[model samples]
Target chain A: MLQNFIFNYIDCPGIQSKNAGKVSTCAGCPNQSVCSLSSTKLANPEIVLVHKRLSLVKYKIIILSGKGGVGKSTITSLISRTIASENENKNVAILDIDICGPSQPRVLGALGEQVHQSASGWSPVYIEDNLSLMSIGFLLNNSSDAIIWRGPKKNGIIKQFLSEVDWGSLDYLILDTPPGTSDEHMSAATYLKEADITGAIIVTTPQEVALIDVRKEIDFCKKVNIPILGLIENMNIFICPKCKNSAEIFPALTGGAKQMSEDLNVELLGCLPLDPLLARCCDEGKNALIEIPNSPAILILKTIVQSNNFQLYIFLFSVSSLYKFNNINYLKLYQEYF
Target chain B: MLESVKHVFLVLSGKGGVGKSTVSSQVALALKESGFKVGLLDIDLCGPSIPYLLDLEVEDVHQSSEGWVPVFADSEQKLAVMSIGFLLKNRNDSIVWRGPKKTSMIKQFLTDVVWQDIDYLIIDTPPGTSDEHITVMENLRNVKCDGAIVITTPQAVSVDDVLKEITFCRKTGIPIVGIVENMSGFVCPSCSECTNIFSSNGGVSLSEMVNVPFITKVPIDPTIGKLELRGHSILKMYPDSEMSKAFSKIVLEITKSKEA
Candidate 1:
């Protein structure tokens, strides 16, 4: 939409230019047809800039869930932490797009980290040597103060995050979106049109109620052409520490994530049991993936990250880099990480 | 917009998934069971869980000469239930609505729905004090709300957010009915043992600090969770359950305050 405005602002060559032998600048411009006011307009300049900025990132994986409080943010944190830990030298960034409820800053222990804006762009707060984050939470003066902006304003901030933030050459740009297939989701897909969106990972609780909504989230991804990497069932069960036995907290009383995935023909990524330690870790701003390395849920997340398609893509990326740089070290690095 | 309803109770919470919808559903059901004509409006635009919490199917809203007809729940009491969930064509079709669209939908839910004369209208709102809260408060400015019932768990994380909800209510001039600390303890299903899962007394201390009444602490009943997943209200299934009694007591406190 912004592209049309920029396209129209360019002065169009009139009939005089047509008669003359001179070639107008508009004639050579890639967006000439769009500038001519054709219905099939050119890509918005802002979106193009967003794509250029995001193309530096290897994968843009969005964490989405239709139901709120379904652990989307936790999954985003877990995945990023796991990847950043494994690929120690690789750059990883998380763009917390949950404008209304930006939990990433506090969850990552980067709360109150001021975002520094330079001539290039806004610099994301580094949570680790290789991992950084950008969130609306950092922009707010007070954590308690609510962001009451409407759809347009929220979209603008998301756009600014995509185009303005200098996330230089990230291996993974994990986008933690708000619940529901609403404004934030739409903006992410629209603005990151040219970015390599590896796909979406839909998170849900192991309850029929949450599964129903998560099914819609998967459907939304299909409609928007954002491939669903898989469905994750969070709070699948509660394991009693004393008895060492698993208990059903919010189970699939009436056809949960497993059944829902079967019915919808989507892959069930894994079920994460309700771990009290994990909750405590998140509340205390600790990394569960690192703190609880043997966590069954974290193991499952690692498996999802090492799926065939993801591995193949990473392999190909390393191979390509090796060829481009005429170096074998990149391949060795990838092999070592894998 | 809701002249026929004598009282309005806007149930809210600052944190999501703290059983605000559950409280709203049970409170409405308890009031209806108490022989009051009730209408439950699920105004949670993005995640409309009232229908699911009540085990409602994807039913269509019929239009009559009066207005859009609220769905009649198959219950003994006269209860009118409406939710944005019902308007969806498919279960997985997400409502990608924005602020203006959500505001208009809320306006329609308030103005266009034919909620017949009722003793109480229980409005279920989404979590947080954002656009939805502001819209509901502004729209119901002329139609006075009896008060708002804030729901929260016993975790400091949740209580922190609920405190914001209390502050928002104070600033907006909405009367604070009380705060209900839900999921205060886990009532062991196998053994009747109570365990403080997320810590206790967070809600009570918060209410004391804010000078508002602490309504009741609803323990995390595993049966209640299962029943909700199965789309059945624990009140109707297990009327004498502790959770049901807690909801009934909260409803009594709300109605009694109205009489006072």
Candidate 2:
């Protein structure tokens, strides 16, 4: 049945036939067995539990990229912050699944905040009235201690992050994934298999080296059947705050994200310029979009969230319009709603 | 696995995109240029930029009865390179692995790869003193590491991270090979005039404060990125370039330290 679907429906250029050799997409595809190739492990029951836990959340969006230091965590934080600021009463949670480099704590301004475990599960640290956060960084003894567990242990914690976390009826759950498409991406996609992901926002810099890796990241998404929400070209240019003259800090040798997105057939969500104030905000563990309200980066992010076709935006819009729950027992309201 | 290897120099940085991989690949190439058998192992399981920087992306590892054989830099040189990038399903696919899987992969890269008798082994590690660094340090406990060369940009943020990296090496008992202040200044492409972009001498001041050898300052060369994009060695692309000269000086200093 899968082979038939591959031969007839799937238009992947790499997939010549059902019996053809495994291509790049085939390695991560759920239907790899239809092509008679075996590499990654198939999904199991833990995903079902993850779905049950995540079902309370209205939308799940993952921020991904092939290259590191492309401001993925920052984007995720910005998106969550933007969504939350739009409605003071709406509930939003950002899950920092970037295990190795859990910069969300630093980025989200929740550093040194501890994750408290009750009989129910681990409770996320509340950052604002509407925004809450869960991260492995919260479980660490210190910021510097290395998280050295292998696959099984890491999988255990990821499962725990999904199934055990008391997320409690969030309007949106923004997952900040680590750079690359290997374990965390696979695990998150697998666990949330039942719960439909809004899509992945692939971030990249305006550099050929960075864009080259992002292309493969797109391919990974295609293979795994993860819907590509759009591609965000971050740090595209450095706009001088003084003279307002623009400079290309990391110049694109080849046409960067815009050209690559056109080639890959993905939506170019928005391009964010390098703002010094924004960088300082991130360093100081403050909300960049909120701190510098008129910053171009924040404006671009707001436009992406407020996009006409974006379902999450509509969902958030409708929720805020219906309920004026701002500070009036918001946790209780969430409990009552769920 | 690298018992036959004479010296191991681990290239590390506290922060990402500080040109740790660039320094690693060039140092290995520089050593090979000096007629020494060198092997570059990229233990940065998360972001293996070594293979990409070295232009060995398509080369697959050959497994023998003994172990996995690393790809040679060129037929003319004795530089062998191994990175997790080569093992990916695609160039853009993320490794997405956790700590344990990454450590295992690092261990396999160290012990399983057929690294024969070589003069120097340069291991390019991922940024941060996290799981990957801990795993490499624990696994290579038996091997004789010459020291670690921490690469950093001439920025306070980058320099601060390098201090943490220095602390990690000290805590783990790894010798400090010295620090390379990469992108110390911007060298004009047309005029060859130098400009302090992130403010030069941050690394020098850091070295002085930390009490470690300050290796060499590699200026920002625009061609370095263009050359890396084309998968060519910087030294081979622009041998007389200021960046190549800086790397050569650093290599000379490293070798002199090793001998001493």
The alpha-carbon deviation from the true structure for residue A54 of candidate 1, after best TM-score superposition, in angstroms, is 1.0
Best by TM-score: 1
Question: Which CAPRI tier for candidate 2?
Answer: incorrect
Stretches of candidate 1 off by over 4 Å are: A1-40, A306-338, B75-77, B191-196, B199-201, B208-211, B227-233
**Superposed Cα deviation of residue A211, candidate 2 (Å):** 2.6
Candidate 2 lDDT, tens digit per residue, A257-313?
878876777777789987656756765688787589998888988988887645433
DockQ of each: 0.41, 0.21
What CAPRI class is candidate 1?
A: acceptable
Q: What digit string (tens of lDDT, one per residue) describes model 1 on residues A1-338?
A: 56654563455553234422133546555555554554344567788889888876777788898877778878899889888988988999999998777778877888778999999899999988999999998998876566766678888999999999988778888999877767788889877645646667788897766776677777777777666656788888766665555667675786788888777766676778776667667666788877888877778778877676456544453332222332123334567988
